[model samples]
Target: MSGLPAFRPEALEQWLPRTLQNHYVDLLLRRIGMTRRRADCFVRLALYLFLKNCQSRKELPKPPLTELSFPQGWVECSCLEAADVFYSDRDRGGDRAAGMMLNKLVDLGLIQKQFDGNCTQVKFHAMPDLLKSDAKNLHISFAIDAFDPRSDAIPIANLLANNYNWLNRNNDAVTYRIANILRDWASQYTAGLRVLRRSDNQNPVGFYAFYPTKRESEVKFFEPPSRGLHLSQVADVDPFQMALAGDETCRSLFVRSWVIDSDYRQAAQMELLLDAQQTMKKMQQDFPNLWDMYTLIIHPSYAELSLALGFQKTNADPKMPLYWMYQAVDRFLKLDMQNLMRDAQSLN
Candidate 1:
């Protein structure tokens, strides 16, 4: 009761996700591969969860990809109880609607679940205990760059530790996570750079992992995020590639992470996008064989964002959540990027 907020609809209106009331939200969500119905369902659920967070007096998690600062982890509850709550139309016994939503959300990289043999734990991609202080007063900001673990490891580890309590809470655990990131990044076959952040040039905030790979490699190793580790699968998409197995050359690239923190919204986001864009743009200089780009989007924002960047879904079904997208390098370079720098105030 102490940490929770009063449940008043109008009073809590500000906290609701746009998807609940905005038809445009679902329309945008559809660009990432959801059918209109599924998108509507997801937004309703998102709004429901937001209300729950308020009833519990929890803070809002940062927006996915764009507003991403840190992954604070999930809310823990039994599967049965969660299902009942998620689908309010249920009788004393809930129907399977919750399960279907769970599968789709997992496929989209929006949430994570862990089974404890007794009860299941759920971690929303962005949900919270509320920020104790105003983000405006925090005075923290990030600059993305080619990741260098040697110089950037400690601060980055500390940043991850501060927000994600589910982490092992030790130096070794952070190291292990870094190792996993490297393994995922290694799959890229094209010329690419691993992205990291420098917070005020001292700390690290979020990971917008980027990798390079061949199309054949992606088809061979591309695993749906719902089936494996989220971090691995989130940035697991590579854009293009070059050279085939034997006596054959190929031109395609797969991007493991084309993450753009949309919380920053248009202007700020384009700046971040340019950082990665420049890297990919440079990859073209030495390796002219580069062409297509591919990714299994991690966040719903990424779906439309990718679409805006000139990507098209491959084997996409509106009724289904899972999707792989492709874009040609020739077209990507054509986007106007006149506004490519962000105001320092957003760091707060």
Candidate 2:
């Protein structure tokens, strides 16, 4: 876990903006599982140094006398200073704390290091792709039903509040609004919600709430105010637009909320899709007029996955932060179910 001592420059603080460093550190912490507080501090300091020194430079400076192998990119830091700054004990146990953290990080494939005299050279491994399957096995279960505001609403609200950090709403306000919306959906009988849970512990991990509508008036509460003209109200001469204007023939389902927890995100997404497919099949059987489904996707990863699953970008404003993606019900149903199984195999 120790590395050869390379050149230690004096001014490393000005290398990166504080905001960028904090963002990178937050992302790294979320991605990896680190338990000990001292280890976490050491890792953060090492990451800061690595980002400031190694990643910012196009090429690393020349190493000292000894020839060393840096398979991944590396940064040189004074061991004593790093320990004093990051570890709890500055005098006696700082070095040991730093060593323990570095070794743990190495074991986790996050970094590599070498020890030389009194200094340590640490190399940062590149973050692996999101689709790269980890060894942890995931077992997700699905449930689809009409929304029950009294019981299901609170849990669903809590799930979204916990998982969707981008949403800026107070917990109580979010829960209240979600409950009211669910109550409205339940009363209308035109919408349903799906919940995904871990099979082993039966804990909820994901949710998808949707409502079918053919005209703007049918969508009572959750209609976006920015959508000035509903599909039925458009006076455009386009044949497709005209077709969608039909009273009951061209129904569209609006996705109100869709989210999955971080740990089960990969496996649970496909499960949610499959669950949606089944739910759509039931909706089609009961309603017999549903045509397509649409959702505003905020996360880049979810947008990419949506595109991979045959969703198309809608004609909504391109400048918007969230992308509006749509998929025909038939096409969605036609997507290869075997792919889900293949993807789940990787999870196991």
Candidate 2 per-residue lDDT, tens place, 3-94, comes to 31332222222343445434444333323233335334544455446534644465554323121112345566555556644643333556
Per-model RMSD to reference: 10.7, 14.9
lDDT of 1 by residue, 226-270 (tens): 332233223344323334222123455555544323232322354
Q: What TM-score goes with each of the models?
A: 0.47, 0.51
Question: How many clashing residue pairs, candidate 2?
Answer: 6
- Which residue runs of candidate 2 sit more than 4 Å off their true CA positions? 1-147, 162-172, 217-250, 340-348
Highest TM-score against the true fold, candidate: 2
lDDT of 2: 0.52
**Candidate 1, poorest ten consecutive residues by summed lDDT:** 339-348
